[model samples]
Target: MDFKYDVIVIGAGHAGCEAAVAAANLGSKTCLITMDMNKVAQMSCNPAVGGIAKGQIVREIDALGGYMGLITDKTAIQFRLLNRSKGPAMWSPRAQCDRNKFIWAWREVLENTPNLSIWQDTVKEIIVENGEIIGLTTFWDVTFYAKCVVITAGTFLNGLMHVGKTQLPGGRMAEPPSLQLTESIVKNGIRSGRMKTGTPVRIDGRSVDFELMSTQDGENDFHKFSFMNDGTQHLKQLQCWTCYTNEEVHQVLREGLAESPLFNGQIQSIGPRYCPSIETKIVTFPDKEQHQLFLEPEGETTQELYLNGFSSSLPLEIQIAALKKIPAFRNLEIYRPGYAIEYDFFDPTQLKHSLESKVIKNLFFAGQVNGTTGYEEAGGQGLIAGINAHINCHGGEPFVLARDEAYIGVLIDDLVTKGVDEPYRMFTSRAEYRILLRMDDADMRLTEKAWKLGLVKEDRYELMKSKREAIKRIIEFTKDYSIKTALINDALEFLGTTPMKYGCKLIDLINRPQITIDNIANYVPAFKQMLDEIEENRKEEIIEAAEIQIKYQGYIERERMIANKLARLETIKIRGKFDYDSIHSLSTEARQKLIKVDPETIAQASRIPGVSPSDINVLLVLSGR
Candidate 1:
C-alpha cells in the first residue's frame, strides 16, 4: 500500500497511542502502524498506570489534552492516592486497572479519533532523504510517506527474552521481534544499546488461599487521574492480596542462580534497579528473611492474577516449586513463567530537546526506545514528541515545558540534558520545583498553553478558566472575612490546635499551620457559606491548594524565586550549532561533551555531566551576555 500521511507513528504501545492521538487531534492526518493491532496500549508488565512521580506526569498529560489520564480513569478497577501521608508534592494518584479493559478502551478511543487511521503491520525501515525523515517502509513491501515519523517501538526492536540458557526472539510473549527495523536504523547511523526489563508470572486467582494473605483495598474515596473525569462512576473497586516470600523461596532461587540468565551472563542489558526482580532483591539483600508479594487481580472477571513482586527467570519447575512455598500461593497454577526481556534502546543524548533526532530531522523517538521505564514516563515522552512533531509540521514553535512548569518538563529535560545510563524512572527528588508542579494545579498550569496550540477543547478550557475565577473569588473572600475569638477557639480546641488570641481574617487564620479551610468552616459560618457558593469540586480544590499555599508558603515562595532565577539562564540561548569546543574558558571534558550533545540552551548545557558552574559562567561571558 503506497500512501501519504501528515504524521506516521510506529508501535501502538502507550507512547504510540498518545503520539498518534496528539498529532491527529492537532489536525494532522495521522496513521498508527503496529505489528499487532490487538496489543494497542497493552500493559506488558503490570496492570497499573500511575505511582509516585509517574502519577504527576499522567495528570500533566491530562491537563495538556492527552488521552492517557482519561483512559486510565475510565478503565480503572481500583484507585488509591499513594504517599498521602506526605506533602501534596509527594502525593501521587495510582489506579489498579483491568488489563483487558484498559487496552480495549485505548482502541475504542483511537477508533473514535477523527483524523487517526490504524494499520496492522511492522514498520521495517524509516525512510529518510537529505537528512530529513520522509516516512517508513513496512515488512510487506508497502510504503508510507509522511512529513514526520515517530518511533515508539517499546522493546520490540530485535527483542530477546531470556530464561536461563533458553532465549527467544520476540517482543512480550508471542509477538515477533522487528528484526529488519533494527538493522535499518543502525545502518542509518542511529545508535542503539541493549536494556532489560522483566515481569512476574500470572497465577490462577481462584487457586490461591485468600486467608493466608493480607487484603489491600482501595482508598475510601477514589482519586481520578483525569481532571475531566468526575468521581460519579468510580464506585466499585477490586481488592489485591499480599503474600510474602520466606527463606524457602530464596533458597530455591539461590540454588538456581548459576543457571539464571541475569547471573549466568545470558543477558547484558541493565534492568530497572528500583523495580528489581525477586532474584536480584534476594541476592542484593541476603540478610532479609522475607519479601512481600502482591497478588493483584488482572481483571474483574478473569481468574488470572499477577504475582507482583515474584518476577524471575529460573527454570519452569523451579519457579513453580518456589512459588508453592509462599503462604497464599501454595496451590498456585502458573499461567506463564516470569522471564526477562532485553532489547535495543538509543542513547537519548542523540536527540534534541524536542525529542527529534539531531541527525535525522523530523524523526522522533519515545518510551523504551529512549531507555526509560514505566507506562506513565513513556506516555509523557510520547505526548511531548507528538506535540513537538505537530508544531514542526505546522512550522510553529515547539511545545516545550520547563522543569519548573510541569513533571513532563522534568522528565524530558532530564532525558535530553543528563541522559540515562540505567533505565530512567522519574522521582520527586528529580524535580527542582515540585511545589509549583503539584498534581492539583496541573490544569491551571497547562490548559492555557494547550489551548493556544489548538490541542485542548474550547469547552474544557472554558471550564478551567471558570474554575480559576471561582478559586480566585474564594481566595478573595478568605482574605476579607473575619471570625470572632470564641468560635475560633472552640474549633481550635476540637482540632487539637491552640486558640488564637486576636480576631483575624479567615485567610490569615488559614495560613496558620493548624487552621485549615475546614477548621475555619467549623468555627465561622461565614467561611462555610462562602465555600457553599462555589461549585463543589472547585470549593474542595481551592481549599486544598490554598491550605498548601498557606502551610508551605515560605518554602514555595523560595522555590519559585529560585526557579525564576534559573529561568533567566534559559533566556540565554545557545544556537544549535554553537562551537563549544573552540570556547577557551570551558574545560576539555565539558567542551568534548558539549560538542557531542550540542544542547539548545545554556540551562541544558549546565546540566550535562562534565559541565561545571564556572564553565557556565565562562560561556555566559563568551556569549556577551
Candidate 2:
C-alpha cells in the first residue's frame, strides 16, 4: 500500500509529535509514523515536564502555538515556579504531570488535528531520489511518499540497553529498537555516532514508608503554562518525597563495578554530564558522603514511583541491596530495575539552523536524534523543523530564530555551530540574551511571529496582543504617576527602605531594589484604583511584567542594543552555491569547516569553531561588504 503526505514525521516521541502537529496545523497533510501507537508522546524517562531552562523552552513552544505546554497544564499534578527569588529572567515554571494523562492528552490533540493522521509502523529506509528525500519504506514493505521528512527516532535507532553484564536490543526498557533505519541513513552519507541516557528504577510507592522521608509540596497559588487560559487548573496537588543515599549505599553500588557495563568498558558512549548515573556520581565525587534522591510519583492514580537521581546500569541484585540501605527505601519494592540505553545520534553540525539536513534535501532531525537530552529541547526543535518543512513544501520562506530572540534559537545555534561531544542539554547560562527572553514574556516575543506564519490560533493571538497592551499601559502609567511623600512614607518605612522627602514617579520607586508594584498598590490609592480598574485575570500578569520592566530598565535596554548590533551580521547572507573551496585566501581549517557546515549567514559563520576573526574579514572582503 502507498500513502502520500506533504510531511512525514517518524517516531511519535516529543519531537515527532510537535513536528507532525506544527506541519498539520499549517495546513500540510502530515503523517506521524511510530512503531507503537500506544507509546505516542510517552515519557520514557520521567513523568515531569519543564525545569530551569527546559521550562523556558516549554513556554516558548506554547508561545509559538505548540501543544506541549497546553497538554502539560491539563495533566499536571503539581506546579512550581523555580528560581522565583532570583531575577525575572531566571524564573522558570515547572510541572510534574500524570504520565499516562500527558500522553493521552497529546494523542487526543493529534487525533483531533485537522490535517494530521497517525500510523503504526516501523520505518525501514528513507527513500531518496536524485539527492532528495521523496518518501520512506516501512518494515512491512509499505511505502509512504512525502515532500519532506522529519526523523525524531530518539533513543530507538540501533538502541542497546545495559543492566550489569546483561545487554538487550531495546529502545527503552521494553520497546524494540529500530535496527534498519540508522544503517540506511548512514549509508546515505549522513554521519552518525552513539550517546547514552538512563532512567531510574520504578518503585511500588504503597510499600515505601513516607514517614522516613521529607515531604515537598507544590505551590499554593495557581499557575499554568499556556497563555490562552486553558481553564485546566490543578485542584489537588501531589507531594514529592526526598531521601538520601549514604556511604553504605555507595559502597554496595561500588561492589557491582566489576559487572557494570559502564565500568567494564562494554558501554563506551558519553552520557549526560548534568544527569549522571548513581555509579558515575559515586566515582566522580568520591569525597561526598551522600547524594540526595528525589522520590517522584509517576501519577496521582498509580502506585509507581520514579526514583529520580538514582539512574543506574548496575546489577539487579546490587541495585536492590543498595536501596535497602536507605531509610525510606528500606522496605522498597521495585517495579523494575534501572538500566542505561545507548543509541545512535547524528552530529547536529550536519544540519542547518532550521534543523533541515545540509546533506539531504527535505530531511530534518530533532530530539535525541540531534543529541539533545530533554523533552523541551526536542519539542522546540520539532516545532521549528515541522514549520520549516511545511514552508519549504508550500513555497514559503524558511523560518529561523535569532540568538537574542528566544531560547530555542540559542539551542539550535549551539548545536549547528559547535558540534556536541556529549549529550546536549539546555541551560539558562547558554543564552546570552536571557534577560530579554524571560519566560514571563515568551508570548510577546514569538506569538506575533507564529501568528504571521499561520501557526498560532486567532483566539490565542488575540489574548497575547491584549496582554501585551495591558503590560504597556501599566508601564506607561507607572512612568507618569507620582506618589506624594505623605502617602508613601509609611509604606516605605514598613518595607525597611528610607522614606522619601519629596513626591516621586511610581517608576522611580519601582526601580528601587526593595520596592514592588504590589507593595506600592497597598498604600497608594491612585495606584490601587488603577489596578482595580483592570480585569482580575490580567492584573497579576500586568503587574509582574510592569515590575520587571521598571526594575531592569537600564540592563534590558543595554542588552537590546548589544543584540541589535550583533543582529547586523545576520543580515549578511551567504550564498548557498558559493564555493568555499575556490576561495584560496581563506585558511585551510576555516575553508574545511565552512564548507562542511555551509552556514546561512555571516553571523552563523562567525560562530563556527575554527573560523577565526581573520577568516571572517576575508569573507567580508570576498562578499564585497
Candidate 3:
C-alpha cells in the first residue's frame, strides 16, 4: 500500500512530535511514524525537563508555538525556578514531570492536531530520487511519499543497551531497536557515527529512608514552563530527596569498574561528558569523597523513583551493594538496574542551519540523530525543521535563527559549524549573547517571527503584543517617575540598600541589588497604583519583565550593541555562491571546512572550525565587501 504526505516524520520522540505538529499546524499534511504509539515523547532517561540553558530553550520553543513548554507545564508535578540567587539572565525554570502524563499529553496533542496522522511502524528505508528525499518505506511493507522527511530517530537507530556484560537490542528498555534505517541513510552519502548515553536505576519509594535525605521542595510562586498556562497545580506536588554517595559506595563502584561495559572494550562510543555515569565519575574525580544524588519521583501515583547522578552500566550486584552504602538507600529495592545505551547518530555538520541535509534536498535531522543530548535541544531543532519542512512543501524563504536571537540558533549553528566529537548538550556558557536570550523574554524575542510564519495562533500573538506593551509601559514609567527622599529613604533603609540623599528616577532605586519591585512597592504609591491597574492574569509577569528591564538596562543595551555589530556579517550571504576549492588564496583546511559547511552567511562561515580570520578576509575580498 502507498501513502502520501507533505512531510513525513520518522519517530515520535520529542523531536518527531514537535516536527510533525509544527508542520501540520502550518497546513501541511504531515505523517508521524513511530515503532510504538504508547511511548510517544518517552522520558527514557529522566522525568524532568528544563535546566540551566535548557530551560531557556524550552521557553524559546514555547515562544515559537511549539508544544513542549505547554505540555511540560500541563503535566509537571513540580516546578522550580533554577538559579534564583543569580542575575535574571542566569535564572532558568525547571520542572519535574509525571513521566506517564508527559507521554499521554504529547500523544493527545498529536492525535488531536489537525493535518497530522500517526502510524505505528518502523521505517526500514528512505526513498530518494535525483539527490532529493521522496519519502520512506516502513518495516510493514508500506511506502509513504512526501516532499520532505524529518528523521528524529533518536537512539532507536541501531540501539544497543548494556547492563554490565549483558547487552540488549532496544531503543529503550523493553522496546525493540530500529533496524536498517541508519544503514539505509548512510549509504546515501550522509555521514553517521555512534554515541553512548545512560540512565540511572529506578527505586521503590516505599523502601527509601526519607528521614536521612535532604528534602528539596518545589516553588509555589508564579513560575511555569509555558507563558500561555496559568500557574495552577493540577497534579499532587512531590518533593525530591537528595543524598550523597560515600567512600564505601565509591569503593564498590571502583571494584566493579573492571566489569563495567563502559570501562571494558564492550562499548567504544563516546557518551555525554557533562552527564557521565557513576563509574566514570569515580574514575574522573578520585579525590572527591562523596557524590550527590537526587531521588526524584517518576510519577505522583507510582512509587518508581529515579535515582539521578547514579547512572552506570556496572554489574547489577555491584549496583545494589553501592546503594546499600547510603543510609537513605540501605533498603533500596530497584525496578531496574542502570544501563548505558549506545546508538547511531549522524554528523550534524552534514546539515544546514535549518536542519536540512546539504547533500539530500528536503531531508532533515533533529534530536539525538544530530548528536544532541537533551529534550529541549531536540525540540528546538525539531520546531525549526518542521517549519522549514512546511516551507519546503510550499515555496517560501527558509527559516533560520541567529546565535544572538535564540539558544536554538546557537545550537544549530554550533552543530553545523564545529560539529560534535561527543554528545552535544546545551550550556549557558555556550551562547555568546545569553544576556539577550533570558528565559523571561523568550516571547518578546521570537513570538513575532512565529506569528509571521502562521505557526502561532492569533490569541498568542495578541498576548505577546500585550505583554510587550505592558513591559514597555512599566519601563517608560520608571524612566520618568522620580521618587521623593522623604517617602523612600526609610523603605530603602529597611531593605538594606543605601538611602537616597535626594529624589531620583524610579529605575535608579530598582537598579540597586538589595531593592526589588516587590519590596520597594510599599514605599512608592505611584508605582503600586500603576501595577494594580494591570489585569491579574498577567500582572506579575508584566511587573517582572519591567523590573528586569529596568534593573539590567545597561547590560541589555551593551549586549544588544555587541550582537548588532556581529549581526552585520550575518547579512552577507555566501552559502551557494562560494567556491572555496577553486580559490588558491585560502588555506587547505579553510577550503575543506568551507566546502564542507557551505555556510549561509559570512558570520556562519566565520564560525566554522578550521576557517580563520585571514580566510574570512579572503572571502570578503572575493565577495567585493
Candidate 2 lDDT tens digits, 1-625: 9999999999999999999999999999999999998888999998988989899899999999998999888888888999989988998989889998888899999899999999999999999888899999998999999999999999999999999889999998889999899988988899999999999899999889999999988985645787775444663589999989999999998888888888899999999999999999999999999999999888878999999899999989999999999988788888999999999999999998889998899999999999999899999999999999999899877899999989999999999988898999999999999899998889989999999999998998988887888888888888898788987898899998889988988888888888888887888777788888866776777678778888888899999999999888899999484799998889999999998888888989999999999999998887888
Compare candidates 2 and 3 on TM-score and give the better one. 3
Residue pairs in steric clash, candidate 1? none
lDDT of 1 by residue, 335-389 (tens): 8889889889988988887899988899999999999999999998999898888
Off by over 4 Å in 1: none
Q: What are the per-residue Cα lDDT tens digits for candidate 3 across 29-138?
A: 99999988999999888899999999999999999999999999888888899999998889999999999999999999999999999999999999989999998998
**What's the distance in Å from true for residue 588, model 2?**
4.0
Q: Which regions of candidate 3 are displaced past 4 Å?
A: none
RMSD of each: 1.4, 1.4, 1.2
Which pairs clash (backbone N, Cα, C closer than 3 Å) in model 3?
A: none
The weakest ten consecutive residues by lDDT in model 2 span 227-236
lDDT of model 1, residue 279: 89
